[model samples]
Target: MSVPENQQEAKNKKKRKFEMPDTYVILFIVLLIAVAATYIVPAGTFERELVDEVERVVPNTYAQTDSNPTGFMDIFLALQEGMVQSGGLIFLVLFAGGAFEVVERSGAIKGGILRAVNKTKGKEFLLIALVSILFALGGAVGAVANSIIPFVAIGVIIARALKLDAIVAVAITFGATFAGFNVGFLNPYTVGIAQSIADVPLFSGMGLRVIAFVVIVGVTILYTWSYAKKVLADPSRSLIGVLDEGKEGESPLDAPFTGRHKLILSFVGLCLAFFVYATIEFQWTIDHMAAFFIIIGIGAGIIAGMDYNKLTLTFLEGCKNLVYGALIIGVARAILIVMENALILDTFVQALSVPLEGLTPVFAALGMFVANGALNFLVPSGSGQAMIVMPILTPLSDMIGVTRQVAVQAYQFGDGFTNSIFPTSGPLMASLAVAGVPWIKWAKWMLPLLLMWTVIAVIMLTIGVLINWGPI
Candidate 1:
């Protein structure tokens, strides 16, 4: 006969298993409503008309040279510029994604990751730090999703083989990497877009961004380790076991690391050498050198025996991965058009300063952060958001007594934070969908990290105030 207490425990287990996280479908509904409202409201009408005007203000490449351009021609100019921006963004995504695919496919990435990880797997503290730096590097390249996702899966597979619960696999590998994305160094989209919008330099927040990256990564490592420990201590609570109960340690899967892999990896190394040499030796932008990496990556992948057909296939797949982001980029442009239409983009800057003119620098930073956050929801596209918001923020910085650089950092915090947990972004959703981790689950994992991060960020901003570190 089953004991009464034991029977109660079973009942509880059944109930708990049936209980699900309540995802706010309302939030999703609200987003749809907002997008719809954009077409109905007078605010939107002004924006639309404003966009029409800007369309006239900007010139087509050919039409721009004519000093006596008509209003119709001006609209043509705006449209032409918009098309160029749209195409450049697509090309940038292609290059970024293609380069990552080529480099990782060349075999150096897995080998490097495996070798480095294997050395520290058993060492908890060391393992945590390594994963943080690993993803942070991935973030810098805008390949956190494409590359980090698989790398983490490999960790999960390896962990299962070793009888470790898979939470370590998901939480440590993907989670840590996502955290890095939250505070990446000069990302093409996140910081790059925000900086561009605010008219701040492309990498204006380098010093603070690095500091934020490290601070957040350190916090995530600690949390991931704790969560992993819980899974290890009580296997029932561990999701990793459910993910791959029968798998074994890296047992030579079908994917073989080849000499071609080594050769490709070597090219990556050479590219790095050139980057270092160029940056220190010639002062090239560390941020723009990503193209060189992509070029080397393609050459190496081909040399390493990635079939020409397969290489192209993989390259296209890379593009496919970012296809949604690319589309979102276009949709985001529509919103930018709306903003430029209203002529309110700069008005936001005047609004921000008028209220907080006398507040401490820390408060001013906080105010900008909030504005950037609100801006993110409407202009979810990174580059689009920047182009919409920055022109105004950049010119008004002097009046607000806040430096353009500080405004840029605020935009970064806003841009980076929302991307981690926002529903509007396809990349985050895509990654979660691929991993079978739901959006609610991501928010659950991320909230604590983001909460702790915000506190740390404010502290840093305050310190900047004390030291007068910002550009103003």
Candidate 2:
């Protein structure tokens, strides 16, 4: 009854189609469910735990909130009220960063950064470390994401063309910058705000922050290199896309090096040296970070031979990209309206903050991760998130016999990791959208890298807590 081997038959072969991860679909569903549940649960508004902090912040800015009944409509309602103003932050940072992107694309800054990343002058690893330190210094002085994000994209593009993984760009920019952001040594935003709330000296934790920066930079390089290898092997596995960076009708390496590039680099170097010396020595604050980048744009624009009018126009164009992300985050902020209505955020915290009555160092770190992730939704702003969570968390850690520094480390991991992938959070989503990558697509690449980081963070957390890294 069987057909002879060669003569009998040919069958159609089936091929597997590419599928988006189930997790991607789940993110949207979760958003919808959160929206619907907020409506079904009748409620009151969330109390501003950081209200005192906010009062001192913008000094009676109209952005203050009050509790209210919740509904599915509340998410949109929050956006309608303009409750999320991060769009402005995004706009500013991205504009400056974007301008740098175009400038680099024009071949003015790319060579300088590459020169920074890989140099014939010193050890290669040390040069990579130096690139990270400079970026972190940018953050320490209060350069926000608007600037950081575009810098990230431009750096990614350059890295890809240079055969380095874009993950290195991401890890260095986000991790080093956030680590510096957390340090608040002279950080324009959170460090000052947090110090005031903690009633600690403005630079009380300065040394620790510097250490954190080094630690995180090391982690970033380690993770980035590891992740980049897999992608280099099989491009599909990369979270950061390899872009066709050769802009339309333009050559990729048209004058990759020019005197204009060196001049801009010299101007930037002079300005950075002046800024850093002033910050550490004279303790100056002319909003120097923003001012510095602005100067870089003007100087780079000129070096690239862009006219003043074209420079100004391109600057504005770059800023436009950030608004998209800011608006998306504004949309995500609707959850706060829901949580406030449900009276759930505090309840959630109550369960978490209590009965840890006694936890070992490792368990305490684990608890911090869980609590930080959940609490992040309610107080999503990192500055605000830390103010609300850290105070309670720091005290709770004492009860568990863990150091506040360990508490801080735990907070960092929680704050830093999820932003890269969470759709409920806007900046990451917006960044992905701008790059023409979707959340689902990003998650595929990030999943493996995130797991690596998670394992590393846990290990680091134990080291912090067990070694008792902080003062008693």
Candidate 3:
């Protein structure tokens, strides 16, 4: 029997009203689970020693410890503690947003993008490839994930001009940066730190890494291009549909490219060059980057002829816009705090590594990749994860007949690729927040590419094991 028209319409409306949880809700649920794991997962510790001023865990030193489950009140306290711990990073996101907003308000970014779009009118693929390669090179050099956040704005503007969605913008910027970071040809954070921990000469296995960089980056370009093509063929196919609707001919792209815009953009370029130099030469951290961004914002404001009041307000407005994304970084860090407080993080590392002991050399290498990928959720920072996991894995690689270099490679694969998908990843969440793309939409679109990259990683690792790629 068919329902009445009114009743049927109501039922259909209810069925179509499914809602995905907000980013904060998803993170809070994960936090609750982490707190629960403290009770279920046994607490353990590994012997750690200071190695070149960096603390590293020692293998075969796992010992069961009394559980320290987080109390109800501590759960709430973790949020404040997380913010305190990650203050530098959180502020960096805010500063970057404010800086970029200052520049965008000056019309430099939009003007430059308009010029590029016109020049590459029919050859948008060329533009995509070039931008992808440059960002990938940035990632390859330093594992600069969070540092790439400011550039997401430029990427979005470009995507909009090309009639693409925010996902494509993120894919070309964050996704491509992560691809090179995962391969890590000369990445000081992941590859350099892991190699140092494993006693492999820094960058000793460059040949294979360089090859992996090319293949992975090639795959990224093709995947992003394919998606862009689909979007062009049918706008509805876009993962994040119609970023700017009802604002036709009202975009920044329609504004005139004035001489002042060129001057402002030139200042931005100089600031970036100095930032890279300082980072490599002086080991600048997020705090330094944050300060640098503040300078950039003020400097750009002065160059744009904005009065003091307008500039300060613009900077504050920019910060206001990114508060949601900036806060996500702190909340995400709280997940780690819960595990650390419970003392289950070491237990998790021990559990993950134990099963790889009995596997064959190639399989052990593959297992390391998978294990590190899983561990990334617990420890998302590349250098931080290296300090924690490499000491254990480095020694295990010898017993399992896997080279230390290959072990390092596995760590790079595990830590780098998964950062793009993990909610625990501050940079990934911040980039999405900057671009206005929802996490669920990004995950649904990126999962396929991630799976393909996983296959490529497995193949590369297998080859590394077979040829015994190493300098150990």
The TM-scores, one per candidate, come to 0.71, 0.53, 0.64
User: Which regions of candidate 2 fall more than 4 Å away from where they truly are?
Assistant: 1-68, 82-88, 102-106, 116-206, 219-305, 341-344, 355-366, 370-411, 415-472
| Best model per TM-score | 1
Q: Candidate 3: global Cα-lDDT?
A: 0.79
Per-residue C-alpha lDDT of model 2 across residues 321-397, encoded as one tens digit per residue: 54443343334433444454555443333445456645666897778876776655443455545544554564455
Clash pairs for candidate 3: none
Model 1: runs farther than 4 Å from truth? 1-80, 86-89, 146-148, 162-166, 197-201, 236-244, 247-294, 302-317, 337-344, 374-381, 423-425, 429-442, 465-472
- What lDDT score is found at residue 187 in candidate 2? 49
* Candidate 3 lDDT, 1-472, residue by residue in tens: 9899999999899889665466577778878998999999998887878766545567689899899999999998998987797676567667766887798788776576556555675687988887788678768865245667877877787787788899988988899899999987765546765776587765667888889899999998999999999998999998779566436565544557789999997897788667756755676655677788899999999999999999999999887876776676667667778887788877776775678766789999988898899978866767656655675676577556788889999999999989989888888989999999999999998998999899999999999999999752
Better of 1 and 3 by TM-score: 1
* Better candidate by TM-score, 2 or 3: 3
lDDT of each: 0.58, 0.53, 0.79
Q: After superposition, how far is residue 384 of candidate 1 from its true place, in Å?
A: 4.0
The order by descending TM-score is: 1, 3, 2
Best by lDDT: 3
Alpha carbon lDDT at 268, candidate 3: 75
